[model samples]
Target: MIPRSISLAIILSILLQCARSSTLDDMTLMLSNMPEDGRLQFPELANKYGYKCDTYNVTTDDRYILTLYNIPGDTRRPVYLQHGFEDSADTFLLRTNTSLVAFLVEHGYDVWLGNMRGNKYSRAHESLLPDDLQFWEFSVHEAGTYDLPAMIDFVLKHTGQKQLQAIGHSEGTTVFFVMGAQRPEYNDKVKLVICLSPVAYLHHSSPPLFPLISLVGGPAASAALSVAAHGDLLKNSSVAVDLIKVACTQKLLSYEVCAEGVFFTAVGRDSEQFEPEFLPIAIGHYPCGSSVKTGAHFLQIAARKKFAQYDYGLAQNKLKYGSLEPPLYDLSKVKMKIALVVGKADTLTAPKDLQLLRKQLPDVVNYHVMDWEKWNHFDMVWGKYMYVFLFNHIHEMLTKYYV
Candidate 1:
């Protein structure tokens, strides 16, 4: 008889609080008991941190179904983060609160992470199967033309925001540059672009075995392998995949395996920056998946030292590009305000290479070099001290622009 309606509201609120608390407890248990080799997908990882994760399936114009993960936030400002070469959305979420996805969401910014074509999450197509060799017939060019635009449009539409902040790591930066140059209109849709460990000019740095491919083997080797394997790269049965799984899973072996397979593949190796506990977690999702053509394209960049279009042979280049030479991307079209998060020890995007790229861009708001001289290419994503050193600068810039 003492205000029945108010009493009902109080009871409902109490039940809701209890439910949230229970969910958090369950999540903590799940994390605490996680197996060494167990890898949680993006949705599960996001929920473990008391945040709601929403997955969006975006169909590119080229027919690939790309997955974008969103951490729902109340803020009107949205940020889209793209992963690097052979990487997936999970790469951005590997370090939990220290990861970019969590950092942005907790700071009142809506966050979205994208998985490019042939990656773990974005492997499906409208009519084609992942096993079909044709599914592996693309490079970053296709990603820039189809995947980025599709993801951007989808995120914008879902969030109902006219413009959003953008962050790209390594190949993410490469693809974004391509989109800005080729699909110039997309430039207007990005508020600020924070480029982490950018990769454009790679003449001085080549991944292991890359020099062999460019010199003696070249496209002939690629063609032979393509014919033999039906275009699938890093196939499940392949020796490379098996070695990666075995070597990287064991604690004792991860140092050599991960350092070589991941760290050395990009740039300098800093044992201090790597966290041994997360090596299995990192390797579980890395080299996510990509076409052999994409691998070949990075080789082309290293060989030519130019951010140019994919090179077909002279005859094919003429037929496809109307010229014997594959044209270099017009960097003049990259009109957005940009920031370069560079490091001193990153061989792939070395200071000289970055200087060449910096000359091409019209408007560079900030060219921030990392405080740690030993900070190398992959450190931006996997460093143990990221939240303390790397993320602080990133957060500062984001805040400056968010206002």
Candidate 2:
């Protein structure tokens, strides 16, 4: 219900720059320049449906911002939604009148959605430059440490409530556990946590991508990306992937394989159906690119089957890459009433991966390795039927667990 005309001129102006020779940094700038009206979708969605939304900076470091959609009803209880990787509050706020978000809005429970750093909406790092991967040093760490806490505190302060219900999907669940484990008091702040497709203690295979990152990626490959120096390489990489996906999709439409490669296998989704929900009109504002040095850090977990720190290119990988270890988090301490929704057919983070997480976390309330039949990593968010089948259980689970 947000007015579409708010500062379209400004958005178009930036879109012009982003479209021409775009880089990671350029994409980062685009979010900051978003029209106030455009940024108010969450709140406006709430308002149009008789709810209110407000977005503000909540990070101690000035980089974390939380967007809250408030709907006041009989229940004083609140629900907070944490988006998955490479997504924003839009994950919960897209053009839909169904799903738990709208339902929660009509029910009068204040529902707030969060955007972690590196993704759009919460990229304001005071000391970090979007042009450099160094600016995104925290990775998922910031999501747990900075973003979650800020969101909780903001919700409590505004709603005048002592506790709230929490829900996370994919990396959203990863961060919930990360935050709860590191800050146990936060466990007290949430009445319950509904985790969708939680991942842990498992090695997933992303077809061609698995080998691609393992053999060609790592710190050294990240260094190679540094030369391109597109701070917004995530967006560019997304573009590259989209371009390739288009070719594959067209071929699929024609009932054939054109080149026969493994690119789609590693990407976590079938190329033919990767059309994201509510594709960002600006596309350039999408900002999840990181150097292989940064990616090299994840290789440790891919190999070790646990969430470990990023390797700082120590003596182990000294020849091709530098030594560095990204921080790690423990997943066991999370006691939230979590729910996991995983696609049966996902290769990126297989359904078995979600099973591993369920085994590790004793407090899980609901667990589903979806019989999606054809679902994959990206299906949980972008699949055309997600709002139909995926979130059907969400309303019942959330209403039952909280308030």
lDDT (0 to 1) per candidate: 0.76, 0.57
Q: Using TM-score, give the best candidate's number.
A: 1
TM-score of each: 0.86, 0.71
In model 1, the runs with Cα more than 4 Å from the true position are: 1-38, 206-221, 235-242, 260-262
Clashes of 2: 22
Tens-digit per-residue lDDT, 1-403, candidate 1? 2133343344344345444554545433423423443366778877886779888899998899999988878548888899988788887778888887777777888888899898778889999997787888888899988999999999889888888888899999998889989999999888888999988777666465465547523445555555566656664334455345444555444455456544655577666876566666776667667777777777777776678888776787899999987899899999977899998887778788888889999878889998887888888888877887788788787777773
